[model samples]
Target: MDSTDLAADGWEPILAAALLGAERAPPGGPGPLGDLVTEADPGSALLARLALHGIHHLAGLDLAADAMEPVAVREPAGPECPPAAANRLYALLTGGYATRERLREWFDLAAAAGMRPPAWLHQALLRHTQHLPETVGAVAGAELDWLARACGEDPAAAPAASDWTEGTLAGRRAAFADLRARDPEGARMALEAVFRKEKADIREALVGTLWTGLSEADAPFLEACLDDRAGGVREAAQRLLPRLPRSLYASRMAVRATTALVIESKSRLLRSATHELVVTLPEESPALARDGVEPHAWEQRGGGVRAGLLRDILARAPLHAFAGHPPRLWIELALRSEWAEPIVQGLFSAVAREGDPAWARDIADLLAEAYEGKVSGLRRTNELLGRWVQALDLLPEPEWEARVTELIRARKIEAVLAILAKGPDSFSERFSAALIDWLAFVIRGSDDLRRDLAKPYVIGRLGERLWPGEDIAATAAALAARLPEEEGGDRLRQQVMSLAETLELRVAIRREFQP
Candidate 1:
């Protein structure tokens, strides 16, 4: 038989003979194959037969079928990215560690320019969205789905509405939060549907998520949660319910608070006619406890729960309840009250949560005093001041900006830096630019460059807005010229130079990505 015929029949016999030995079971048949058998032994002869068969089998293997099917090609939904844009995208992927802000800008520029990223880079962009989906806003839906499918994932795996029940606690919370931002009622319904089956921890977290869209509409549910067996759930309800300006809990708290204080305006003649506003605090009501005015040790130190109950009432009550009563009146009343610290603390909370810029600005002196250490010896004052700076974020952007500049000019460097440390998310473009200009002006006008440049990093960030541009060149050169001969000066100059380089790179990147 030919090698192919022999192979098709069975190569096992030949292999077995090679392994065992032809002496054990010899092939008695004589042919061309038998004549070619080696003289060494049965094993060697079998080896020769197997090698020759393999060669014949491979040589005679079939090449193609009689008829071939046609290949199908589909056009992509979008146009390919321009050569320049594609190169930039490739650099961002391989360059490593581009900031989320920069990545977001790149995605925005590419989409706006109608450039679809190359298919090869799909994996790269998809991998980036794993950590920060916020950057996905600028990425096109078609590209995103295509990339996901290419990565062997379902196109709808990262659905617009996530399956909240399928992930870890943190992951589920994140999903719920995202859903809450998009559809508050839907998120609430999803949580409520599973509430009975959820564990205590999850119930607490789901309740907390209501803060994303807290309103009078949510009051019925939050009020129901007040009776929850879980302390965390009940506490979250207590915290969030009062934030709703028109909620029953807020209204109840406001009524209870207003009743505790009596504000009277009297006109009396000392030298001439003058106005005096008097505020009086009455005996504590046992009913206040039900409105979330429970006494805490922090407040008890001032005197007792009775002495501090007014502050708790003020805190829980909406600031709008006191709309007609001026902030100066409240300040004056707080100064006169036995529970001044708690009262002031409550005012900060009210103004902050209520987002009353007028009241917030009115309390600027109190905030500054606390920050300057004049009013911070007490733990309550220190804590309230901490909250005050945070509440500063809720102030109208322009007002907050003015306050920041005021703080910087007053040389409250630590306090100004503390506000700055809250990050760019806290500062508007107007505030950031103005603050940087203020800092630069402060540095340039100062005779002590050595001291002014002590915090080069902060200076560097503020200087980032102007570089490779003409505006910053003079300031940078001036700073460099004043660099001391010591190590500190050398460090300062290095930072200044680094700031310039960063700005230069940013400018070039902006140009490269321009539509």
Candidate 2:
């Protein structure tokens, strides 16, 4: 029959019977097999009987003619059959049954015939058969072997021993490995005894199967196995133990790395640069030098003058740990190192925190020198400006105002202007007024500072701030007086006019700020 014919006529009857068989099986419950039985309805039992006959016919076997007679017909007068006959009938039905439902019916029939196979029937079938063939000999052999094993009569110790071999053990092992992945703990329990007593090679094979299920909970078991006589088992456990949480080694390392040292500033300039100059070292000291002033310097020098250990200590200490410490100490150490890049980075991080600006400006000048004539100057400028903007917001208005005053005092008009330009919108108005006043001061001050103040950045910052609703014309007029008679002057004036137009500020740029 074509597939459609098989499904519609032949398969439907077979399926119905299988369903009834499932419903009759022991341990019945609401499972897929139960649902099948429910759906088949009405003629399920009849379908099951017909399906059992069909399976025997398909397998080229026949029910024992006398055995086929109704049970009532043969029960009193027929020749008695051995229990083996029931198993033979079951084997034929199962071996030839095409669907799981049909096999289930055969199982039900065997149970009813007082020939119930043992609970391990499925496992036993899977264990013995290498190949299933249509021959009656093969079928009979499988059924007899199952019967012999299930009868609590060891097939291996039978009078005529079946030829089971080492290959059977190999097959079981392979099957268990596959099952382990699906249900790790179940598989482990199945092999637990064998795992402890198996030969070295076999034990290694079993442990390898367990790697997928290894977890912290399994650590104790694995730990106990660490001293396994087999090298492979020991190695496997050792490899897995370290990856568990709360490992002993990691805790030990963390504890050993925690000591603190105090580093004093080396240079007289840096020592007097700030009143407090103590550097605290924790277990995680930065990979830089740590020397500073020793408290007992005179005693160490035997009451005579000697060189300070600050430079040597700082040179030898780790530099990373001081990254979040006080800025003054970092700056002093950085300057002592002649502004090494690592020390510079640490200083930058410290300054990035909102702090007093008198020191910040001096550090800025030092940074400016460090950055001068280098390709990275613009990057460094942006980094410092970004940090300065953040610090400005955190400090109170008065503190920011004091910082501006410090910038002016240090003649750092360009840096001051940069800071004002990048300051957040909340501080824009205050910075704009302060910037104009600073510019005026610079313009009217010593010629040298005025020349420095007239750089493009300063002028650009001033132009950017002269937005609409401000007195742009007056600011432009003041700026014009400071413009030099050079090409740079023309560029500055054009930038100022562009800024005015973009911001919609109605300002007249005089000929002076232009060139």
Candidate 3:
């Protein structure tokens, strides 16, 4: 009998007997299927009929066409990643050794090099990019698309560029941020469309994404947010507005600073020296103070003027307002100002936000000079000195080392090493040699020196960045030679050995990258 005919006529009786355990209800029925079953024992008969029904039903079905849609053929094939690099990526993702940042670097390089990772790696990479949206912009779109298709995934299934409206709140934030970095206008438009309906927390998060591509284009929307019904939403807008130098909030801050502080100049030889900037404070601050300066609940101290308000105004004021004087004059002004701490803090904030290497170096030099021998005299300056040193570190390469070394020559070994650690992994070859020589000298004085050098922050970074070329092997051997023969020395020796390994790995990786 046809499979359909057999099922149409005999399935119910077979099902009933199977459910009844064949003892209570025999497996017989009224058709050929039932007749066939009747030839066997009750239990065996029931099983036989069920098995035949399945086979016949499957044989007559069109499963493939019914279940799956046609996939369009992908265009001209994408290039595959190099074997060595591919191996490295697979090892990095699967080996559990690579940090999140390192994985991102690999993804970025693979994408930038126009190479697609092996299909198996796509899932891992997709998951990785979800947490690191900033890294998404670095990954090549074509590589992502290729990865999705090759893995039997819909080309749109890759998580790197998932829709902003989809996913958990955190996932949506990450996706929104990724899109914002690339297409700020589009992201803004998307956000504004659904923003009013979002919950307070989600609205705050969505507004925060505006920081990615903040410009005058975003000013109007952010300005309107100042009046938002939610306090969190309004506060977020307030915090971000001043960061945009050209924003109206910043302009108002500039006006406030101009109104409150004035720099005076007096003639000195052929040049003009700043006499002092006159700071005018309101007898009592109004609620406007809360707009720029955060409102805090505390008893007021030091009855001169409102220090917090002054700092808030200064920090938000345009850096250009504090310009035109050399860093020395600026520091002098800051040190002597009645609002000295506020002024100093403002200058530091401006230098950091301005991102001028020269300004940063100058500020670092000035602070170092001001605090020179009288380290105990200016206790406050000493506290702020760490921040200035950190600012110096942000300068490119040798500048950080040069300025730091100049300032910290009189500092202790720990102090010098602290500054050194803040710098990039490898200095110029000449600088690396000097540093290695200095480290070797320090090691001679104490076994503990080796412990410090062994730190991943120190040696690991040094190994990665130090391109000592011909001197690497010699330097490694020399460092090892300095280790004392003891338990501590053995650990030191191992640390040095690890440095050598890292250098070798970096060299191999670099060679792979070479065309």
Candidate 4:
């Protein structure tokens, strides 16, 4: 370790000579390398030996190894997202109000394009989309460690087993609902674990989870709940039990329905019997309340409420208990019944809840006839008329245009808007075109309608509800362009232009997610 020895391997002696001009040390390396300083080129030999040995000196230096291996991160998978599409999602995460509001559209487009959020956007998405595990898992599988940690810290982040015992009420309900889907038996045990001790909100939400995947398996549990003290739990049970036809509660309702309502027929000479529905309000039973019938008089005044009680009861009744006929035939006959009011209401309720396509079709056909006046006896007020229009949505999408077009050209503004309101925020292209055509019709019609459509609030609501497809917007703009540029057209023109502009902006927002 002499200072001049310098630890330069066997070349230290040569290095010393180079620096201090000490006696040229004898070559100590093996064989030809030891004889490196030949008389032919001693200077180059020394430099060459120093250079080669320097690499060996560094390699031989002692160093500590790493204490642990680096944490493994999931490798991101999926096609690369388009630059523009990823940017829009970035804007949303970075506080772009316009883009954030259309998350559903962005999701649809992102899914269609088969690209997930880029790795860099993962953390931002985790913080912002705390509740959307599907989005997190879907777009950023690599970020699951972040998501798992997030769910642990915040119950509202995602459903978990712990959610059943603790965390936010919403988290508990979400956990319970998720359990209902994956393990109905486990969910029942979870619900039963806390049903007696939890407050009404918790109890209610747990029972309500039965709404999906409702089956006879849940019947006994729900039937026991009907006797619970909490109205929420009882009401949830009441609502769900009726969907299971074989439940004892349904059987009781069926008995009551058959007894209270009978189809009486009168004989005719050599002709078919004239059949009609004869509804006689049944005597009240304590079991009625237990079975979800509200305790209200059969004839309580303001028209629909008291009758709604009966409607609620019959809603749970078996379809066959009402009559031995298709929904349309029975509903038509009920329209002529002495007690048409409650009977018709109950029949509609039953059909709506059942959602049998054939029954839904029959209901839609009959209701459409009522709407068109081809069928009579079902009297409707303005409010009922609005509901009737909305009900037409049950008809398949193909049949919608003809009926909707007839309503639009007829200038049935309230009814058309009712149908529009009932529709999904993003309408089918054909429906959007119809809406645009209606907008044009309204612009050309009366001054009052035109002024109403021009209002900021009305137009804003439309922008919120309607999908802003480029074609739909362009069609509307063309309609505005075609109108004569007169004083009467000025305000209406601006309104149409405004709607078109709104649609265009939304279309662009959607396009940001597309390739």
**Candidate 2 global TM-score:** 0.29
Q: All candidates: CA RMSD in angstroms?
A: 9.7, 28.9, 8.1, 11.1
TM-score of each: 0.63, 0.29, 0.66, 0.70
lDDT of 3 at 353: 70
Query: Which prediction has the highest lDDT against the true structure?
Result: 4
lDDT of 1 by residue, 74-138 (tens): 34556776666667766766666645545655666666666667777777776766543353544
Q: Give per-residue CA lDDT, model 2, range 37-96, as digits (tens).
A: 433444553454455446533543333345333322111212222445444434544554
Residue 321, candidate 1: alpha-carbon lDDT: 78
State how far residue 52 of model 1 sits from its true place (Å).
Answer: 22
Over 4 Å off in model 2, which ranges?
1-327, 350-398, 409-428, 441-451, 463-469, 477-488, 502-515
The lDDT per prediction is 0.63, 0.45, 0.65, 0.68
Comparison by lDDT, 2 against 3, better one:
3
TM-score, structure 3 vs. true: 0.66
Worst 10 residues of 3 by lDDT: 295-304
Q: Is candidate 2 or candidate 4 better by lDDT?
A: 4
Give Cα distance to truth, residue 404, candidate 3, Å.
5.1
- lDDT for residue 257 in candidate 3, whole number 0-100: 73
